[model samples]
Target: MERTESNGPVTVPALPSLEPIRLVDRHGRRTAEPVVPSPDHDTLMALLRGMVIGRRFDRQASALARQGGLAVYPSSYGQEACQVAGALALAEQDWLFPTYRDSVALLTRGVDPIEVLTLLRGDWHSGYDPRPHRCAPQCTPLASNASHAVGLTYAARRKGEETAALVLMGDGATSEGDAHEAYNFAAVWNAPVVFLVQNNGWAISVPVEKQTRAPTLAHKAVGYGMPGYHVDGNDAAAVYAVVSRALAEARSGGGPVLIEARTYRLDPHTNSDAPQRYRRDAEVAYWRDRDPVSRLEALLRAEGAAGDADLARFADEAERVAADVRKRLAEADDPDPEDLFAHVYASIPPSLAHQRADLRDELREG
Candidate 1:
């Protein structure tokens, strides 16, 4: 990748590096040129804790899906580094626009686990107040939230607010027309927004190879007059550093950025998916060895940044979170059928009102 001058006009790189940027290698060894300085000790510790808890939360959600606690769940298994870093990189005032697969990210942002799973539980449109948390609902339609993020950031800029937005999507999302429009609008308007594509090798059943012909998904940003970043998504430190830098630049009016995080999805796309039908066992085994949580833990121990006690504490915290998730989800009340007509509008339309009445009548008859 070509480097731009520190002084003078800002320039977008013509292309992202052919290889993904990596701070920590698979063996948890530091890279030769560790481009971005490692985050301070405390930040590093937080990243580790987030990833650890995120993995546990992911496993619990997947189990819930299998046991009927949720209607559906898109587990972020093996993508904890990307999920945690994305949430941690943002400031409290900034917004996070997440897709269905980003529950781990939402959890890291301090959203309640029960609320985070409410949509998957087939209950509410959104369980939490977006305005209060600065997080939109977990979008199910691929890439649709991209436009919403751009609109919010642009509007915030117009209001003289310093808020920025981070939009998370999968590799499959990059192909959608909405994603392209969002990219173009954000660049043209100089909106403070960032697009993060977790290139986890597969888009449900389709691999990244079929998604685009571009060298890397990050290169797509060059066409929109914005910077693109390619990072090893399995490396928590690298993901955090890159996303943190992108958010800082966007908040400073440097415009938008697109980041492609190379990672893998160890579990099926959702509980219903049969990954074995498409991918082989050997491929999954390869990525299992590069597990993000273990990789980060190794780095911590190697650097003497964390010891056995610290690791145990993180594990204990994760167990507590899992237990809490189990209890709250089990205790969650079934959604009110009437709620279907509740949040869509301030005043219900006549047609929907009639339908709501019919549903109520049917329920009463039953």
Candidate 2:
């Protein structure tokens, strides 16, 4: 679509193709013709390292949940490509709005593993300070962060900052009302934001087939008057390239772009979810063969971009991260009950003050 501005007409990005853009096949072979430019060797290696670490982190977090270190965990085991690539695609100045399942993405963005898991541990409202890291709290409510992303980017644009916001959601979030509202608001206001829907084929047992009737989630972008991209979520290189391009366009006043990453959630939605009751073993096995970490590792080895020593280094780093996470989390202090009222507001309200006093008196009596 073309729109006339003060200086001639500007061409909006064309509608995305129905096929998810793929740079590499499931077997880790480069596609005959990639839909977008592939990342260079350095970027590929970086992506590989990030995915390896992310997968390790995800596994460790899950183990912690089972061992009582965390209250629960939403594993991103099969979707490391989306998590690592989404974080790497952004500039440091850009903001990231992530969902509960995106802890790996937050870790990729340099958030501390302890802080990332703090919310799941039920110790704090948010694990880390949102402003210092330019990442919002990992939102648990479906699609609510979408509107927050739009509002932040729109405000940044007004202040003449070349900042872009990337909001990550799952396939289920697309079905939420806030997601649609955010989509419409971003397009209408031309907010410098990108929405990445990690469509992992299920909304907690309800498959994508039952989610919407749209040919593809990317098609929904046309209704919002914004460009949409459909990309193979397992292909780390493709995800990074597409997201990088979308973020660039957003920062350059091209408005918001919605990306539907075709990936799969290999694990249950959370620790409490029972995949055995919802999905078949055969289906899980199929996605396991397309594991993002191994896929990128294969491509690197095939291209001679990564040697055994290099791969070993990445693996060692991953192990170290896992060990550190385990050690620190185990050593964490128990949360103080009084801390709940600490960050609630700048000044305590009358009702809360009364409650605090009552709690204090009750504790004293005990």
The models' CA-based lDDT, in order, is 0.91, 0.93
Best-matching candidate per lDDT: 2
TM-score of 1: 0.94
Screening candidate 1 with a backbone cut-off below 3 angstroms (N, C-alpha, C), the clashing residue pairs are none
Q: TM-scores across all candidates? A: 0.94, 0.94
Which whole-number lDDT from 0 to 100 does residue 256 have in model 2?
A: 95
Candidate 2 lDDT over residue span 1-366, tens digit each: 688989788666677888999998899899999878999999999999998898899999999999989999999989999989999999989999999999999999999989999999999888999987799999999999999999999999999999999999999999999999999999989999999999999999899989899888998998888888999999999999999999999999999999999999888899999988878999989989988888888898998999899989999999999999999988889987788789889999999999988888998999
The C-alpha stretches of model 2 lying farther than 4 A from their native spots are 1-13, 345-366
The residue-level lDDT of candidate 2 at 174 comes to 96
Cα lDDT tens digits, model 1, 1-366, are 444566545555667898989998999888999868777778889999999999998999899899999999998899999999999999999999999999999999989888899889888778787777789998989999999999999999999999999999999999999999999999989899999999998988998899889999999999988889899999999999999999999999899999999999999999999999989999999999999988888988998999999989999999999999999988888888998888799999999999999999999999
